[model samples]
Target: MRIYKVGGAVRDRLLGIPVTDIDWVVVGATTEEMLAKGFRPVGADFPVFLHPKSGEEYALARTERKSGRGYGGFTFHASPEVTLEEDLIRRDLTINAMAEDDQQNLIDPYHGQRDLEARLLRHVSPAFAEDPLRVLRVARFAARYAALGFTVAPETLELMRQLSESGELEALTPERSWKEISRALMEDQPQVFIEVLRACGALKVLMPEVDALFGVPQPPAHHPEIDTGAHTLSVLEQAALHKQPLTVRWACLLHDLGKGLTPEEEWPRHIAHEFKGLKLIKAVNERFKAPRDCQELAMLVGEYHTHGHRALELKPSTLLELLQSFDVYRRPQRFEEFIAACEMDARGREGLEERSYPQADYLRGASTAARTVAVQPLLEKGFKGPELGEAIKRERLKALKAYKEQV
Candidate 1:
């Protein structure tokens, strides 16, 4: 019996990219042999198993049936009728279809190596249109590998477009859609995926609110070309260029979502945008079933985007009081999130960029900088704790006063 390494783990290794996971294929081992070897029977419905000693997964090569609709519509056949070559035939792309034998022998049954050399993502078979989920998956691969600068094979792209228009993917439950959407959001080049989604027509069905953002207008001074949708994607691109975490990036993607639903008025009449934004935030979070902490961070960002003159006028003590008043510390993770959101809010506008809103100074130097301010010394210096806190309060007043004098 010969076993081999397979899939992205092998492909990534060959390309010298850091592999994120490892997969294996045993060409001749039966499930009973695997079980006899103490592997756990984990694929009662699917033929996958987990080795007791290694914990890595192993699955018998299999083929699929378009038995149902959407993601769940597929049925599998792995017992005898299908071979490893047949299983590989149903895979979405050649780059993902090749396998590696334990002896490091290269398996090129589908010429996947040639496609990899050519930087192409070609479907294994014309059957790509049978599953709607492949549309998003291919788009996601584009995003993930956008840096690699490969192009999707023309036939594969056509298949994606056809499947999307056929509404086959619409049968996917919110959970399944969320799976791809969440991964797409987490990708290093999310905008690439989004643009590809738009190109393929999947965006319209997957997220109309976002799809509607295309060509939506923004203030002329801030954004010279395109509308609010373009601005949001730009912000998302900026977030991607940094090390900001997933939830923060998600906020950046959705921060200006309200603009799509808001009617036109004067410059920045989108004053009520934050309130409307809060409601929309809930819908997005609930629709995607995002985590609880993410929901709070989203709403807080939506609420304070209009932070007003107090932001410019408040004393540091008052600022601390204000921060404490909102119980911001109740969720420290949420506070870190708010800073990221603020970066998005302040950076999301083209007008702000045009004016050179002192990008770094605004987000890092001014808004989110941490101040320790000798707390123990203030308490030790003849003032009671309350008095000391009040003194710290006064210290903020002094700072704000100095700021006003400078201004």
Candidate 2:
């Protein structure tokens, strides 16, 4: 059997990027032969094995045919007869279809290297439309490589449009869709992922809440971007620019969902949009099965981000209530993430990206001041049970008031 390093490991190496994972494709190898050689079988639907020594994945070269619908609706054929070219042809993108042999020979059957140099993400074949997951995969690649000036090829985009209109994207499982969404959000240009999905019409089908924001108007006084959708994407861009974590980025993306729900007559104003957004955030969270931390933070930011923005004007009682809602004393990191999301929102507007967000530091300082009021001191003063709770609340409010006045 001839083993060749393939897929991302080959592509990333060619791009002078640090290759994180390596995959091997074996030509002329059968599953029985792989097992006989002490390789551990791991793939349930195909002939994939872990190396006997390195524990790296090495799958026997296989070809697939579209069987039904969605990503998992494919049947695979793997045997000694399967060619390396056949396996490479089934990849989602041209850049990923290249391979490297043991002798350091580059296999360019589909001109992947040519497309890579052209900074285009071209599909390997028309068969790309057969698997709906490739739509998200291509968008994610666009997000990852956008900083490098890479864009989806026009023809490839048309195919993506076809997939989006085919109603096949609905066949994808929530878990699988979330995997792509979360990874794309963490990429260097997370907003590009959303933009690309929108360009191909997949966003409307997969994330209607987000899609609805595109043409909605916002008050230009606060958001120079004007369009709610543009503002949401800008917030996501700010989150990525600051190298914020996934929870913060996800929160920023959904924080403005309520604005999309605002009535057309309301125009640039979205009264209580934060409250309106909470339900949409909950819907997205439930649909994608987002991580508990991500779901909780998104909900918090959606419901109370306005309170965070109005930190300077809120009464000490209101500040304390906000902190209590966040349970800042117990889950301090979530509070920090909430503040980060709010800051991203504040700075996401056009010509306002570099503007200072004093609200962030103000809220952080408020939390600190409230936290400094020692519960132990009250306990020593004989405050007990509910009385102790009341006394501590009173003390925290007093501290917050003092801190606010000093600022």
Candidate 3:
């Protein structure tokens, strides 16, 4: 059996990037042979194994045929007869189809290296259209390599558009879809992921709430970027620039969904859109089966981002209420993520990228002051049960009030 380093390890190495993981393809090897050699079988749907020593994944060279529908509807064939070239041809992108042999020889059967130099994301073969999940994978690759000036090949984009129109994107499981989406959000140019999906019309199918924001008007006075969808992308861009975590980035993406639900006659003004967005966020969370932390932060940002923006104007009691609503004492990190999401919204407007968002610091200070209100003192004074809870709230409110006066 001949083993070759394949997929992302070879792709990243060719791109002058740090290779994070190594995947091996064992050609002319059967599952029985692999097991005999002490390679632990791990792939339930296909023949994949962990190496006996290094513990790296070593998948037997396999070929697949479209059997039914969606991404998982595939029949895989792995045997001593399957060629390494056949296995490479089934990859999603050209750049990822290349492989490196033990002798350091580059395999370029599909011209992957050429496309890599061209900074293009091209499909390995026409078979790419068979898997709807490739749409998200392509967009995610676009997001990851956007800073490197990569663009999807025009023919590849047409295929993606065709896939989006095929009604197959809806068949993907929520868990699988969210896996791609959440990883894309953590990429360097996550907004590009959304842009690519929208370009191919997959966003409308995958995330209609986000798609509805397109062409919706917003007040030009506050959002020089006018279009709600454009504003959302801008906010996501700012989140990337600030290196905000996935929770903050996700919150920024959904924070404006309610603006799309506003009446046309109301035009650029959206009254109580914050409350309206809560439902949209819930729908998104439910559909995607998003992580609890991500869903919680998105919901908080949706319902109270405006309050965060108006922190300086809120009464001390109101500020205390907001802090308590976020449960800052128990989950302070999520509150900080909420503030980051709000800051991204504030700075996402055209020409306002560098503008100050003192609201973030204000809320952070308020949280700090509220947290310092010493529940121990109340307990020591013989306050018990619900009475202790009431005393703690009273002291926190009073401390916040005093801090507000000092400010």
lDDT of each: 0.70, 0.94, 0.93
Put down candidate 2 lDDT per residue, 52-113, tens digits, no spaces. 99999999999999999999999999989989999999999989999999987999899999
Residue pairs with clashing backbones, model 1? 68-73, 216-227, 222-350, 222-351
Q: Which digits, one per residue and each the tens of the lDDT, describe model 1 over residues 57-111? A: 8887777888877877888876644567877788888888888877787886888
Which of 2 and 3 is ahead in lDDT? 2
TM-score versus the correct structure, for each prediction: 0.82, 0.98, 0.98
**C-alpha RMSD by candidate, in order:** 4.5, 1.1, 1.1
- Report the C-alpha displacement of residue 188, candidate 3, in angstroms: 0.3
Highest lDDT against the true fold, candidate: 2
TM-score of 3: 0.98
Q: By TM-score, is 1 or 3 better? A: 3
TM-score of 1: 0.82
N/CA/C clash count, model 1: 4
Per-residue error (Å), model 1, residue 128: 1.9
Q: Give lDDT: candidate 3, residue 137.
A: 98
